[model samples]
Target: MDEPKIKNMEEFAAVSGISRPTISKYFNDPDSVRKSTRRKIEAALDRFDYRPNMYAMNQNRRLTKNIGVVVPYLADPFFAEIARIIENHVLSAGYRPVLLGSHGDPDLEIDNLENLRLIKPAGVLLAPLGRVSDAERLAAFCADVPTVLFDANIEDLGAAFVGSDNDQSIGLIVEYLCRTGAPPAFFEIRNPVNPNANKRRAAYIKSIEALGHKPHLLQADGEGWEFEQIGFSEGTRIIQEHDLPTDTILCSNDRLAIGLLSAAYQAGLRVGLGDGCALRVAGHDDHPFSRYTCPTLTTVSQDYAAIAQKSAETLFALIDSSKHFDSREETLFNGRLVMRGSA
Candidate 1:
């Protein structure tokens, strides 16, 4: 008599003499299992002519193998670079990455969270639009999902937060600038959107004071992420009106520095460390385009690799253990100063 037909994954697992969990693992990602296990499963599949229903299996599982990665703005190269690293790590861990960008909108940020919830993702990595993000909604979402916040953080809103230590980074650049030339003035948007800007402003003040130099702030009037335009327009006004407190300026970020560079160039001001140079410019975050500017920008480089790795690892740990931490965790990496012609 012919052997009985295999009806389901359970029957196939029993006949193949493999554990059910291992069978499920192979089905979820064939390469996830060892080569030996894969060959055995393939042989069994050939003999039984049975294939697991992927959709049904995912539905039955307690958690899907999908990891959601949401950022405040995907257009920003900084976010794009970090997201790419996180995506690679997620794929390597046999989980699918679902990437979403809020385009710097708080309402859209909430919408992204709600959509992720519908998918029932195993975990999430979020970079919230700080200061504007709905705190109550974020807190509620974290209560239900395992999330690791990166880049911009909202206090106590995720399982953990991994980001650059703004204090250390700002201080590093400030000390470098003060040592090289006259103490630098801080330039930033008057009402900033990112939480990091506030931290950086405070850090600049603290560092300058420690070095016995008065802090000067040049607040530009504008909103949203059009930092370059704000920087150029305001920088032009400052330059033409002779309003700059110091010859050297430290922008809150590279985009602003780029704009300031343009303004200075248009005003016939030389920007560099050599003779005939009228001004020095520096920025933070070492933005992707910073080095390519006419006079390369000097800035502090955030430890992007470390932040990405730690954030992903933290979320994966939470998912695997199937538990939240007793207390929230935050890991901060220091920045390194990148010296160039601009400063």
Candidate 2:
């Protein structure tokens, strides 16, 4: 005769003649139970195939092993990539990862956090939509749940912040451009979505002025995460209308630079360091597709690996100790300059 299938821990306990609470304790941590009890549980496991629902098991416990990872927009490859790294780290540390995307909406960001609270996650890793995020609500949420902010920060809302140092990154690219060729003009969205854009703008101005160059701003018109389209549309208009004040252009990020490159191609303008090239373009983030553009692209690469590793480690430390840091911590990784064909 075939062995009976045990549907859950309860059924297994009943067949093994073990109390349900003892079985529950064993499932949580086998070492917590007495040796004889553990032997009985192991014997029953050999006879019957029973696997507890991890989610259900966590639901019953006071503190769960779930780690929530929230990003501003998962559709963007940058956020998706970083979220993947953070998830792997959380899983390796023996915790469940619950992923959520805000889609660039503040309300949705808040909703994601609220949902994470329902599960009582061990901790949270959030890449907030800076500037647009509701500061009061986010602060309150962080107060109740231990959260480590990454990517874009919102001041002192979280236990810690981990991201790239915009000042160092933008300055590195700016100095490089000034050294090799003409001082580059900063290209940015008139109304930016990420707060890092503001930092880059300030850094560009400061770096250019320090080098004794007059900074020219080529602010484009757009909002949200459609950076490429904005860059293309605005770039084309600027080129056609003879609006660009400088031959060298430094986009706020690589996605925008990619679109600008397309625009330059459309305008019959050659871009690169080679002879006969009419323009030189560069950007930030060293976007995954930057190297494949027509003339490639010279850009700043964010230290995503370091940011992800530190954020995960910090959150886990908080969870394990059940204690908050005496003071909030912020870790900023410097960006590396990636020189390609574009500039």
Q: What TM-score would every model get versus the actual structure?
A: 0.87, 0.91
Q: Residue by residue across 1-343, what tens digits does model 2's lDDT show? A: 8789887877888899999999888876678899998998898888786777877677777888899999998888888889999999998887889999999899999999999988889899999998888989999999999999998877888999998999999999999999999999999999897889998999999999999999999989987888999999999999999988888999999999999999999999999997998999999997778878889899999988899999999999888879788899999999999999989
Model 1: per-residue lDDT, tens digit, 1-343? 6666887888988999999999998887798999999999999888877877654676777799889999988999989999999999999898889999999899999999998887788999999999888999999999999999999878889999999999999999999999999999999999999999999999999999999999999999988888899999999999999998889999999999999999999999999897999999999998999999989999999888999999999999999888999899999999999999999
- Root-mean-square deviation of every model: 4.7, 2.6
Q: Cα miss at 215, model 1 (Å)?
A: 0.6
Candidate with the greatest TM-score versus the true structure: 2
Clash tally, candidates in order: 0, 0
Give lDDT: candidate 2, residue 273: 94
| True-vs-predicted CA distance for residue 127, candidate 2, Å | 0.1
Task: Output the lDDT of residue 226, model 1.
Answer: 81
For each candidate, the alpha-carbon lDDT, in order, equals 0.92, 0.91
